[model samples]
Target: MKWSEISIHTTNEAVEPISNILHEAGASGVVIEDPEELSKEREQVFGEIYQLNPDDYPEEGVIVKAYLPVTSFLGETVDEIKEAINSLVTFNIDIGHNKVTISEVNEEEWATAWKKYYHPVKISEKFTIVPTWETYEKVSSDELIIELDPGMAFGTGTHPTTVMCIQALERTVKAGESVIDVGTGSGVLSIAAALLGAKDVRAFDLDEVAVNSAKLNIELNKVHDVVEVSQNNLLNDVKGTVDVIVANILSEIILLFVEDAFNLVKPGGYFITSGIIQPKKQEVKSALLEAGFEIFETLTMEDWVSFIAKRP
Candidate 1:
């Protein structure tokens, strides 16, 4: 089978939303090539080596890529994707150049392209994300490992938004506590909560593709018994309050459901929000506060932000 690659040149602020647009269009997974990765210094914990090539990343801004099967409706799909991305400007997101290009590739190339960009990385002090295809040894007795396949879902669970969410989960999730993960995507956060000793976890995603992928990843991580994956809109039709609520989606979408999240979290429980760019941090912070949440902690990585708010 043949595949077509859709590459978008945009700013870091637009990465998460544009990736979602691509995924909704049936892209298997998205790849982010940020020039920052080439120049930034990283702590080489666990002797993990990062082999980066300047040629593979954009010189400025970010280049987001995704693969779509060569289908009869490919043109229409691309048009819709472009329109969706362009519409993000209304949210005050800086899209930068927004240049898009498409190219054909062999099935083998599409299948293996993700391997070139994803590797095992220790995203937090306790949680490390390893690709399903890689071999990684545990560095400590308490270290947690999350295995993901970018080809099967979203990007490797190492995006800053995901990293922050997992780190927040590590800080907030207690043993046997219940967790609700909204827009669970590949179910990475749900798996993390389960690994952190969450006895009952409910994972929801509106997209059926994301629901299936989350189910696969949850089972792959051996957390299916603790985490239940389902198809549902954010917090809607969700009954009962949980000890923790984590949502790693765009801040705008996060705003739409702040009240629901506040109401669904038990008193003194936590609500973790990520996938927020720097510019929108204050807006989300205000919304959470308005919904009667006390901000407990704020986490930032690169140009992204995550908030850990407590219901008092």
Candidate 2:
């Protein structure tokens, strides 16, 4: 089947809104790309890797690419899709034929695609993250199982940073303690905390999509009563101090919000941080010290580090 690849370029600030407009205009799926996320070198590398036939990569603020089968009729005309996209910002639109052929993908094949990348990930001696699509018959019944099928969401416990955070959670969070997970991608840590005997757990993310995804994951784990997933920035909207806090965000954002994180934790509460690149460990440690936190322990995995610190 022939497919039309509609490419639209606009500023990063306008990409999401424009993508929404195009979707409303009858595009099945919109691929949003942030220009800042891709450099010239990256684009060239991507083109070479995909062996793109058209061999064109846009260099602009932000780009939204959509593919629709020619036979599939859009509720709106091509001109209407173009005009709606243009209204979002100053953009350039290009239409091309997709050299890539389409094929039918069944549920079993789609499930295998994700399962291939996931394995029986052992977070600690007592905890293991098992993808729902795969069996964990080798795992002992005494171990805690976190059944997850993270589809397009952040947390799968496979990422080094996520594993580091999970390890930290296992070691630090105690029974009956209140926990708050900031930027709780996939709610893995939060759900794990609940499973580990956290009395009260609340998770929040800046992305609504992530929040919704986390809600689904929370339900999947059957921890809805203990873990509450919501949309919030850090702990700005949360009230009172939590016994423990977990944050798995970039080092820069972690440093920026260190003080706020400190304020959200109880005086003797612990704060666990991950997503620190190897080169930025000292910088993050310095920020933690400056925030009046005493570093307790640090775990490093594949150049990523997770730090456990206590607010004094």
Candidate 2: Cα lDDT at 37: 32
What TM-score would each prediction reach against the true structure? Answer: 0.97, 0.66
Q: Kindly list the per-residue Cα lDDT of model 1 for residues 234-309, writing each as its tens digit.
A: 9987899999999999888999999999999999999999999888899999999999999999999898999999
Give lDDT for model 1: 0.91
Number of residue pairs clashing in candidate 2, backbone atoms closer than 3 angstroms, sequence gap of 3 or more or interchain = 0
Candidate 2: lDDT over CA atoms? 0.69
- How far residue 43's Cα lies from its native spot in candidate 2, in Å, is 37
Q: What is the C-alpha lDDT of each candidate?
A: 0.91, 0.69
**How many clashes show up per model?**
0, 0
lDDT of 2 at 196: 87
Highest lDDT model number: 1
